[model samples]
Target chain A: MSDDWSAEVEELRLRRRDAMALGGAEAVAKHHERGRLTIRERVTRLVDTDSFKEVGTLTGQGRYDGATLKGVTPAPYVMGLASIDGRPVAVGGEDFTIRGGSSWSGDRKKGGQGGFIEDLAASYRIPLVNLIDGSGGSVTSINKRGHSIFPGVHGFERSVELLGKVPVVSAVLGTAAGGPAGRAILSHWSVMVDGTSHVFAAGPPVVERSLGQKIGKEDLGGTQIAVDLAGTIDNRVDSEEACFAELRRFLSYMPSNVWEAPPEVACTDPVDRCDEELLSTVPKDRRKPYNMRKLIGHIVDNGSVFEIQPTYGKALITCLARMNGKVVGIVANNPMVYGGAMDVKAARKQIHFVEMCDCFHIPLIFLVDVPGFMVGRDAEAAATLRDGMRAVYVGLQATVPTYTVVIRKCYGMAGMGTTEKNGLEFKIAWPSAEWGSLPIEGGVAAAFRRELANAPDAKAREREIEAELRAMASPFRTAEAFGVEEIVDPRETRPYLCRFIDAAQARIRTSLGPKAKYGVRP
Target chain B: MAAIQVKADVAGSVWQITTKVGQKIEAGETIMIIESMKMEIPVIAEQDGTIDKFMVDEKTAISEGQVLAVLTR
Candidate 1:
């Protein structure tokens, strides 16, 4: 009986070895040559050292001859529970070396294992980090297995359930087309390696065949296309290590689940440390472009601003930062781009960013300098108004505390979207701030065009009208009319923002509960 | 080296031209300023280069992605 038990143990060891080999030594070497880490290697690097406890190591495709194994066993997917920064998390990745990481032969086993991991994370309320590198579903499987069954709402239902419940992150390390791409986007935050990763609904071959146009894989779904142009993913890092670092930073600002509040660190930077330079940061001459980034640095906690999509939406700046040691989302208008007007792209960017912040229960700080939504035939063609309306709708729906600071130009519908009309808790403005239905320079021409055209000196009359409108548009008048709550000095911004955070901290804590209604939309 | 085209990122009217043809300019030096959406955006040189030519004159309306100048590195 002892000899029989030893032989059975030996067989189990051989099966485990085969499953661990992935596609084989040569295939793994090829994968390395292309500058990609294996599935196990990625998971090891992502999690805390020696903290990973794998869930399914011996489950894979197997072949046998009367109880004796004859071929290599392939798991194709690896999953486990691990600790990241001493906090528990569930992680999984596709073994791309096996059948190109396609869901072909062992999908039933893969789905069972994947579902188990999701369930484990959901039950324990831990973050889920997926490192996806697959060829999505395989066409060859159809020929070999005589077609597959289609179930409505099967793959993404688990992800949807985990959306408002816990944080989900995905790192696209290699080509992630079709279903894998969908998973990457479904996560709350996603990062892709610059050159090695690509994501798309369909690869170039499928597009060429269907649309009769030739295109490269990089052009179709490279980091630049997916992140900068399409805004499909949150970030694009130079390497896998950078991607992991970004994930760690992003998760730091979020709770393990919505059941908890974001962790707070001790405040090191003095809340009242105001820079006198902020007084002159926004030029008195509204036409001059001053750096808003510099102003943001002086207001938030020192070195705590982490900008998101800095390149895509030039006019609207969106970032995550710490105000008085509490995580907050910052949205400011960049005067360097279109005079900080909300263009179609900028509107879409703000709408998406606001939705993400609202879903995570992060309070928002709006530093408005919007002149108005972009105006012209080009803006009309871009459907700027449609996107602008969406931005306003999302801005109003936000349940988190919203603090608005009208730093400069705040006019037209774009200004209205900066804060709710029902009086925000901290809707204050600076001396440089000015708000109106429209800018005097552009509005004067349209409103008194006929009068100017008929005047003895059309140019002089135009100038006179503009001067009168400018005086009426002063921030003082808005205060006198009770339209603006208060106008503080520029130097008071830091202290005010810090005070708002301190005052709202208790409210944020009390607001923590089940986020059953606000599941994030992909 | 290839000639780099300095492009306007937003639709606007050129307010001023800061650099002249044949003038050596450093990377990120403003070549021209465009007034749009009630603010001025500077079109900067991408690399250290000599200005080859101006593509648009002051007060000329240029569309987004339109080339404002050519610079030869």
Candidate 2:
């Protein structure tokens, strides 16, 4: 009986060793050199260390002969449960070594690797993190083994259905294109491994054939272009290590799913610590532009903001950050970029960011410097109002803790809520706040143009009217009407926001039905 | 040269008309203003053209994407 027990123990040990040998450090290192992380490594990094519990471990390629083979096949993608910041999460990581990390046979596998990952995240009610590093779904497998697999729009529909159920994160660690690109986009937050990768719906060859444009991958859909000009992708990084690290950081502010608030962690940046410098950060002169990004740094947890679409919609700043080590989405109107005016492109960019954060249960932080929406013929030519107002519409529908700070001017129809919608929470303002149907300078000319024209000193008269309007625009005047929430000191911003978020950390609602779905958009 | 219509992107009132009819202009040149929020948005010419027609007088209320002026290149 003792000998039988010993034999069973030895066999169990061998099985454990075989599991560990699936892809060891050497495989990880090889993928790292290729600007990618191994599936196991990515799963480990995305979730907490020693947290991931993988599924579908033995699924792989079939052999030609009846004889069995041990090292013949490897599951290219790792999927299953894990704890992110101590909360249960699901992860899908691509193993580049398996046919260079493309699910060469995912088409025949029926769900496509991306589909399986999406299903796991949805069924389990856990946030999904995709560590993509491949040349899309293996085309050779699909082209060669045609009748066995099917791919279509359903792939995208599955992801969209899973959107509001939980926070979806994507880390592009290697060349992601075609099907992989589709997977990467299903995230509220996405970051790319800079030197090692790129993403696009189609390759340059496809574009050249279809659109008659000869462009390289770097110029057309590199990380910088995607993050800056297109507003399609969210974040960009320098290496695979950074990409994995970013996945950990992004999950910090978002809950495991929409049913919960972001997990609380010990915060090193004390909430009470105030930066007095923020008081003087904005210059007294309204014409002069100052760095609003600086103000963002001062307010959130130290070095916690992972700014998305950093280059696109420069007038509006969107980022994911931690307040008291709990993830929050921060969107600020930047005076530096077109005086923080919401433009057609900016509007489109912000709406997507807002929806993403709200869907993921991240508390929203809005710094309203909106002098108004961008107006004029150029704006109209670009369908400015329609695109710009879309953000406001989306904002009104959000069921998250929204904190709006009136750093400066809030003007016109865009600023004043329409007939139906309610306003933001903690509607605080600065002392220099000013809002109206329009700026007084422009209004004065329209209302009393004859007086200005008749006066010998037209310039002087105009200046005087501007001065009076500026005075009326003060926060004290707004407070008298109870239009402003509170005139807060710049230093008090951190403490106030932190406390508000803490108190308002309620379970978020995800209204999507029991099954997955998606919407059609250009 | 024929005219091209450059429309307002956001709804607001015309703050000013920077260029008159027949003024030669280039792409991205601000020709008029629309005040929204509290700031004045300069309406720029989308293409290189000569100002052929003024769509609205100064201080006139406008909707977003409304044609503000016609330009001829």
Best by DockQ: 1
CAPRI class of candidate 2: incorrect
Candidate 1 global TM-score: 0.93
lDDT of 2: 0.72
Give the local distance difference test score of model 1.
Answer: 0.83
List residue ranges in candidate 2 displaced over 4 A.
Answer: A1-35, A44-47, A66-71, A98-100, A104-114, A137-154, A267-270, A322-327, A376-378, A416-426, A446-460, A506-522, B1-73
lDDT of 1 by residue, B1-73 (tens): 7798888878889999988899999987899889877667888777899989998999999988788898898
DockQ of 2: 0.07
Question: Tens digit of lDDT per residue, candidate 1, span A1-522?
Answer: 354687778877897788788899999999999999999999888888998998777777678889768866576778889989989998888888987786533434443124667787788999999898987776666677696757422467777778768888889999998877888887778889999999999999999999998999899999889888788877889998888888888888888887788778778999989899987888777788888898999899998888887767788899999988999999999998888999998998898778777767788889999989988888899899989978987787677888899998888888877885433645789988877888888888889989988999988999998998888778888888787888889898889878877888787788875544443432
Give the lDDT of residue A126 in candidate 1. 94
Question: How high is the CA lDDT of each candidate model?
Answer: 0.83, 0.72
Kindly list the per-residue Cα lDDT of model 2 for residues A49-85, writing each as its tens digit: 7877766665655444555333435556667778876
C-alpha RMSD over true interface residues, each candidate: 1.0, 4.6
- Which of the numbered candidates is closest to the native, going by highest lDDT? 1
